[model samples]
Target: MSIKLDYKPVVVLTDYMYDSIQPFQDVYDRAGFEFRPYQCKTAEEIIQVAKDADAVQVHFAKITKEIIDALPKCRLIVRSAVGMDNIDVAAATAAGIPVANVPDYGIEDVSTHAILLMLAITKKFNILTRTVQEGMWDYAVTKPVHRIQNRVFGLMGCGAIARCAAKKAQAFGMRVIAYDPYLKQDQVNDLDIILKSAKEVAQESDVVSVHLPLTSETKEIIDREFFGWMKPGAFLINTARGGVIQERDLLQALQTGQIAGAGLDVLSQEYIEKDDPLLQMNNVIITPHAAWYSEEAEFTLLTSAAEEVVRGLNGEPLKHPFNKIPYAKQL
Candidate 1:
C-alpha cells in the first residue's frame, strides 16, 4: 500500500519580508507546498491570514493570543529574527505550534552597527558630517575628534552579538569589558573581555554599548541610576532593543551632559510622536530600528529563516527555536 503526504499551505504574514525571501521560492516549490504571501498591517488581519496556514513566516508583525487561537491549522510559527517578544510564545506553545527564529542570522551586521554607533559618537561624526555639509569648516577644526584606540568599550550583554562586538573592538585597539549574569567567568576570560559588575562597567568604560534583549527585568535597565554610574564624558550606543534604555532618563542625561552623547538605532516606540523629547535632542542620533537591516543581513535572515521553515515541515529538529521561554518558569 502507498501512503499519501499531506502538504499544507505556508502563509507569510509580514510587510516586505516576502521580497527578501523571494530567492527561496524554488525551495518551497520543490517541497510540494503552497506558499501564500499576505501583508498583514494589523493583528486582526494576521489572524485572518494565519487561520488556514500550516506554518507562518513572521517579521515585526505582532502575533497575539487572538491570532494564535485563530491559527488552528498552524503547526509552526517562524520569526525572521531573534526577538520573539512580538509573538505570544506561551500561547503558541499551548496551541502546540512550534515557534522558531534566526538567532545567529545577523550577528556580524548587528555587531558592526553597534560598533559604528560607538565610533560615530566617539568621533563626533554626526556633528562633523552636518557641519561639513553646511559649509562650516571652521567648526571641524575647533571641535576635534577623539581616537577610538586605547578607549574602554563595555557591553551590557555577553551574548553572540556582544562577543562579536568585543572582537571588533579589539580589532580597533580598544579594551573590552562586559557585564552579564548568565555568562560564566571562564567564557568572559576566553574572549579576553573583562567581566565586571553592571555598575563598574557603566562607570569605567569610555563607551557603553547595550546588547541585552528586552525583558521584564531588562526593560528600563538603563535608567537614572545607570546614567548616574557612567563617566562624565562617556558615550552610549544602543543598537539593542529599545525599552532596554529609559528614554526620559536618557534625554535628561544628555541635556545635563551626564553622558557625552548617544547613537541609538532603536527606540522604545518605533514611531515616536512629533513632540517626543528624543526628537529635540541634538546630541542623540536615532535610526528607525534599522541596525539589523543590511543587504547582507537581510539576505542571511531570509535564507536562514526559510531554511528553518523547510526543516520544520520536514519534521527535522529546529536550530533556533524561540518558543522555549525561560521567564515562563517564574509564572
Candidate 2:
C-alpha cells in the first residue's frame, strides 16, 4: 500500500530560535522531503528564502499576509509553539492553507509552574528568602501570610492547562471557579469547578490565575477595570501570555493596594530594562517566560511540531489545526 510521489516536497523553517533542527531534519529526511531552514525575522526574508516551500515551520518569525501570498506552493504552516499569534491565520485561511500548532506539549509543565507561582507568592518566598540571605531573619518583614485552605482559586480560562490547574488547586483545599465562554457548567462539574462570569470570578477568588491565549480579544484584557473588580489584597498569577495583563495598570494596582501581589512568568515585554519598576517590587515574582520548559516538554514540543510537518506532507490528518481549510487544498 505504499504510494510514491515523482517529486520531493520542499519544507522550509522560516525561523527557529532553538539550538538544533535535528528533530525536524530527521522527520523531513525520513519523509523524503527537502528541508530548507532560514533564520528569518521579517516577512521579506521569509518570502525571499521560502517562496516555493510546500510546507512552512515557524518559530519566532512574523508570518504576514505578504509572505503568505508569495508562497504559491505552500499548503501548510506549522507553528513550533502553542501560540500562533505571529502567523496571519486569517490570510492563510483565505489562501486555503491549513495552519497548525503544538498546543498540548507543555500542559503539565506550564500548569505546574502556575501552581508554583501561586505557592511562592502566597508564602512570600521572594522577600523571605532575600531577607534571610541579607543577614535579616525577621518573619515580621513578610508577615500576615494567609493559609490557602478553603480559599477561592479562580481561572480566567478553562482549557486543558487550566483544567489541570483546577484539579491541582482543588487538591490544595482551594475551591476552584472558572470563566470560560466556550464551556458549559456541567462540563466542569466532574472537577468541582464552579462556572462563573469573569467579573464574578475576579471578585470571589483569593487568587486569580490567567490561562488564556493572547489574541485580539484577550490583549490587555486584565486592565484597570478588571483589577477594580478584584478583591483587594488578592494575588494575581499569569503563566500565560504577557499581553493579557496591562503592565501599567498592574503596577498601579500594586501601588494602590488593589491587589496584594503577582506571579508573572510572562510580561508585556519579554526583556525589560533594568530600570523597570516591576523588577524592584518585592511583592512581584517574574520568571523569564520559562514556564514551558523541561527536558521532556522540549522534546515533545520539537517532535510534535515535526510530526505535524510530516502529516502535512503525507496528506494525513493534522492533530492540532489552528485554521480551517478544505481537505483537498491541504493536500
Candidate 3:
C-alpha cells in the first residue's frame, strides 16, 4: 500500500518578521507546503491571517487567547526569536499547538551589543558625540571617561547572554559578578564570575547589566528600590526586555542623578507617540531594541526558525521546542 503526505499551510505573521522568514522562503517552497506571508499589525489581523495556517511564524506581536482559539488549524507557533513571552503559551498548548523558538540564535550578537552599550556609557560616547557635533570643542574635552579595568560588572541573570558578557568583561580585565538563583554555584564558579545575591550585585557593582527574561517575577525588576542599592556614579545597562526596568522610575532616577547614566537597547513601548520621559533625559542612551539585530544574528535566527519549521513538518523533534508536553497529553 502507498501513503500520501499532506502539505499544510504555513503563515508568516508580519512585515517586521519577514526578514527572518525571507531567507527560508525557498525551503518552505521546496517542502511542498503553501507559504503565506501576511502584514498583520494588530491581533485581529494576526487571527485573520493565521486562521487557516498550520503553523504561524510570530515575532514580538501579541498572540492572545482569542487569537489562539480562533486558529483551529494552527498546529504550531514558531517564534523567530528566543523570547516567547509575547505569545500565550498555555492557550497554544490547550489548543494542541506546539510553540517553537530560536533561543541560541543571537547570543553572541546581543552580548556584544550589551558590552558596547556598557563601554559607550562608561566613556560618555553619546555625550561626546553630541558635543563634537554641535561644534562645542570645550564640551568634548570636559566630558570624563573611565577605564573598564578593575571595575565590578554585575549581571542580573546568568543565562547565555550573561555568560557571554561575563567572558567579555573578564577579557577587558573587569571583575564579573552574577546573580541567578537558577544557576548552580559550581557552574558560576567555573565561569570565573563572582556569585552574588541580586541586592549585593546591585549594591557593589560599578556597572550593572540586566540579561533576564521578562516574567511576572522579573517584571519591573529594576525599580526605585533596586536603583537605590546601586553605588553612586555607577552606570546601568539593559539589553534585556524593556519591561524589566520601569521607564518612569528610570527617568526619575536619571533626573535625580540616582545613577551616573544608562544604556537602553529596549523600551516598554517600541513606538512612542509622544516625547517619552526617557527621551528627555540627556544622560540616558536609547536604541530601538536592536541588540539582537545584527546581520549575522538575523541569519542565524532565520535559519534556525526555518529548520524548526522543517523539522516539525517532517514529524521530527525540533531543535528548539518551546513546549514539550507528554505524548499522551498531546494526543
Highest lDDT against the true fold, candidate: 2
Off by over 4 Å in 3: 1-9, 12-21, 139-144, 272-274, 326-331
**Candidate 1 residue-wise lDDT, 58-103, digit = tens:** 8888888988887677778888888877888888888777888888
All models: lDDT?
A: 0.81, 0.89, 0.80
How do the residues 115-179 of candidate 2 rate in per-residue lDDT, one tens digit apiece?
99999998999999999999997989988999899999999999999999988988999999998
Cα TM-score per model = 0.90, 0.96, 0.91
Lowest summed lDDT window (length 10), candidate 2? 322-331
lDDT of 3: 0.80
> At residue 100, what lDDT does model 1 achieve?
88
Worst 10 residues of 3 by lDDT: 322-331
Sort order, TM-score high to low: 2, 3, 1
Per residue, candidate 3 scores C-alpha lDDT tens digits across 1-331 of 1113644546555435543466677667777667776667888898777787767877777788998898777767788887778988888888777888888988998899899999888887777788889887765463566788999999999999889988999999999988898977888787898789999999999999999888888999899999999887899999988889987787778889888899999877676545777766667778878888878888777777766776675566667677783121111
